[model samples]
Each structure stands twice: as structure tokens, then as C-alpha cells.
Target: MVLGAACATLATVAALRSGPAPHEDGSGDGGATGGPTAPQAGQALAVARQEFGLLSGGGWAQAWDLWTPTAQRAVPQAEFVRVNTECRPPVGVPYVIDASSVPDPTTVRVDWHRADTTGSATLSYRAGRWRFAPDARTLADYRPGADRLIQNRTAAGSCH
Candidate 1:
């Protein structure tokens, strides 16, 4: 009986040390919350923050690099830089991450706002890393007239 108890204790310790059990989909349960693990969420949020930081800091090319390959294919680099440059946000404007959620094991959806502008972006985990994935509407709006659209969306002259 003592031997059996020792073995059981060892097994319990091992399980505890092994971290949270993965769900059937092979994603960590994040301890009863039913979403991406904390590390996964942090990584995704870090990507979102970094992308926005780069954009706000006028590192447009670097910010564009954070985009998922699929999003990059949908929106060319030059066009993205051009539109954003034309409607750059004011210096020191703060963007708040409103909320984030796991849409899937490999995707995080982040809702954010800055002054009068609000948006949602998807971060995809692929190739062992996270990347920003703009939605279809965003891709469509990043065209030649995007400056006017962005200015109109934000308080007049706020994003100019």
C-alpha cells in the first residue's frame, strides 16, 4: 500500500509539473478559462502592440513586415505606406487595446481604439510565430482614397 501511494504521489507531481492539459484541438485550456494559454495570448498581444507602435512611430515598412503573408499579398507595401503616411495619427495619441479573444487555437482577435478611431485586427499563429492579419474590409479600404476615408472616420483633421 505504501509503494502504491508513493507511485500515485509521483504521478500527481508529474502531472502538476507538466502544466495545463491541452484540449482536444491540441490547444492549452489556459486553466479553465477555455482560450489560448496566457503565453499565447501575450505573444499575440505583443505582436499587436508592436505593429501599432511601429505604425504610430512612422516605421511603416517595419510595421508592414509584421503583417501575415496573406494580408501582405492582399495589400502591397508601397500602397500601405502611402495611405498611412497621408493619414498619420497625431504624435502622442494613445491607442487602447479594448479586448482580445481566441477565435481559434491559432488566431487571436484584438479590438482597439485610438481617440475617435476604433478597429479590430486578427493575429495568426503560423510558422511558429504570430503575425497581424487584417480583415477584408481593411484591405479594401487601404487604397488610393484611404487617406480621405480615414480622415472622415476620425474626428475631422485628427488623423491628418
Candidate 2:
């Protein structure tokens, strides 16, 4: 399973890299000058990709480390691992980051799709780094023993 996940991560990375060449500042503009938010958007997208890679590779602790402080406070590390491990998302499924928008100077919204699942996540720039900031719904759904989100994902064929 770990091997499969690693392969998937590699494939995902390859797909992303092959899609477009980013500017020196990390903006996916092929050296074209983007707006003020372009660099920050790129940073948030990188952080989001790293978090998802960690999750897909079963690096739960590392993935949790990328969560915002508020998200960490809402869901304990053990509970997060337990829930994810119990039902685990499918391995080797490539995810596509569709779009990213900067809602504010400090916040970015990323839209992504994996298999049949489409979702969004918010990332906040804090203390000079970007972190996943789970919304209220996500935090609630990730609560200990909560299975609704898992069930939905499983039904959608995104998780097993």
C-alpha cells in the first residue's frame, strides 16, 4: 500500500510539473508578470500539494503538521490519524489542482478534484508560511468518531 501511494505521489508531481512552467517567483506564468497575489497563490498551492501528498502517502503526522493552529486545536493528532487510517483514501488516484484564488493577502482558496471527488481548501499565510486552515464544516466532520465525511467519500469512490 505504501509503495502504491508513493507511486501515486510521484505521478501527481510529474503531472503538475508537466502542466506549466512557472516563473522564477513561483507564479505559473512562464516568466510573465502576474498580479501581486500570484506569488502568494503559488506558495499556497505548493503547501496544499505537499499536504495532500503527505496524506496520500499515509504520512499523517507530517500532514497534520501543515494544518493551521486552529485546525490542530479542533482535531487532535491521534483522532485524525485514526479516522484516516481506518478508511483510507484510495491509493494511486491522481488529483488535479483546478484553480487557486487569493481571497485576501493572507488567505488563498484552492480547488481540486481527485477521481470523482471535488473539494476546496483554505490556506492561510501565517508567521511567514502557508498552512491549511480547515473550515468549520471540515473541522466538525473530522471530529473524533465522526463518519459522515468518510462515508461520503467512500460512496463517491474517492475513499475505501
Candidate 3:
């Protein structure tokens, strides 16, 4: 009885942590309906928060994975890691994330304010799930003499 009860509790916790059951198509949508579901929308915000936590925790490579393909290409892996780690938010420890709005079923905006600074990031639905700034671009002349064609789009701002 004790063993069964423990197993049941663990299962319940796992289920709660995992959130909604994704569709058979694995879109995390309500399944067969059409657009993004409540669970999927909640998951998007969760992903956005996870990305911020990853960055604050110094998981540079993992955080890099959160960027869109365009953003990834705009900045080289080494350069991205260097710049981000160098410019990490001054927020001391136990970084906080406060999600404000989901502009649409497919997008979310989360905020962070600390150490006398405030910033935010936006995530959008992609092939199947949420991603940070699925259309990030670099600042003008961010790369000098690299001959890289600049993409002009909303940049994933600081600490994103």
C-alpha cells in the first residue's frame, strides 16, 4: 500500500509538471480543433520563461538553441556566447520572470526587472512550439567587414 501510494503521488506530480497532453500530431494543440489551444498557449509562456532561466543560469548553448534559425545565423555561436555571457543582466541571483501578455495564441511577451534595470522578450510559435524571436535581426553594422547581409527585424533584446 505504501509503495503504491508513493508511486501514485509521483505520477500525479509528474503529470502536473508536464502540463497538458499534446495531440497525436504532437502540436500540443487541443487536437483536431485547429489553432493553438489553451495548453499550448500556456506552454509557450512556459518555454519563454525556461529560456530566460536558461540564460540566467549560464546555459549559453541551451539558450542559444532557443533562438530562431535567423537569429542563430545572425550571430556566430562563439560570438553569441561571448557577448551574452559578457552582458548578462545585472540582476543578482534567483532571477525572476514575470510574463505579462500573450499577444496572440501563438506568441507571448515576458518581462524581467531587477538591479535597477527592466527588460522583456517575445516568443512565437514556430514549426510546432514556441521560440524566442522567431525573426530576430542584428543591429546595423553589428558585424564589421563580415560581408553578411543584414536582416532588419525586431532584435531579441538584452538578456533574451
Ranking by lDDT: 2, 1, 3
Clashing pairs in 3: none
Say which candidate scores most in TM-score. Answer: 2
Model 2, stretches more than 4 Å misplaced? 1-39, 153-160
Model 1: residues with Cα > 4 Å off, grouped in runs: 1-39, 144-155
Worst ten-residue run, lDDT, model 1?
8-17
Query: Alpha-carbon error at 98 in model 3, in Å?
Result: 2.6
Q: For each candidate, what is the lDDT?
A: 0.70, 0.73, 0.55
TM-score rank, highest first?
2, 1, 3
Where does the lowest 10-residue lDDT sum fall in candidate 2? 28-37
In Å, residue 102's CA in model 2 sits off its true spot by 0.7
TM-score of each: 0.66, 0.70, 0.56
Range of the 10 consecutive residues with the lowest summed lDDT in candidate 3: 147-156
Better of 1 and 2 by TM-score: 2
Clashes of 2: 0
* Model 2 Cα lDDT, one tens digit per residue, 25-128: 54324533443333356667777877777775677877888898779999999888877787787755656689888889889998889877799999986544
Give per-residue CA lDDT, model 1, range 22-52, as digits (tens): 5555344535655544447767777777776
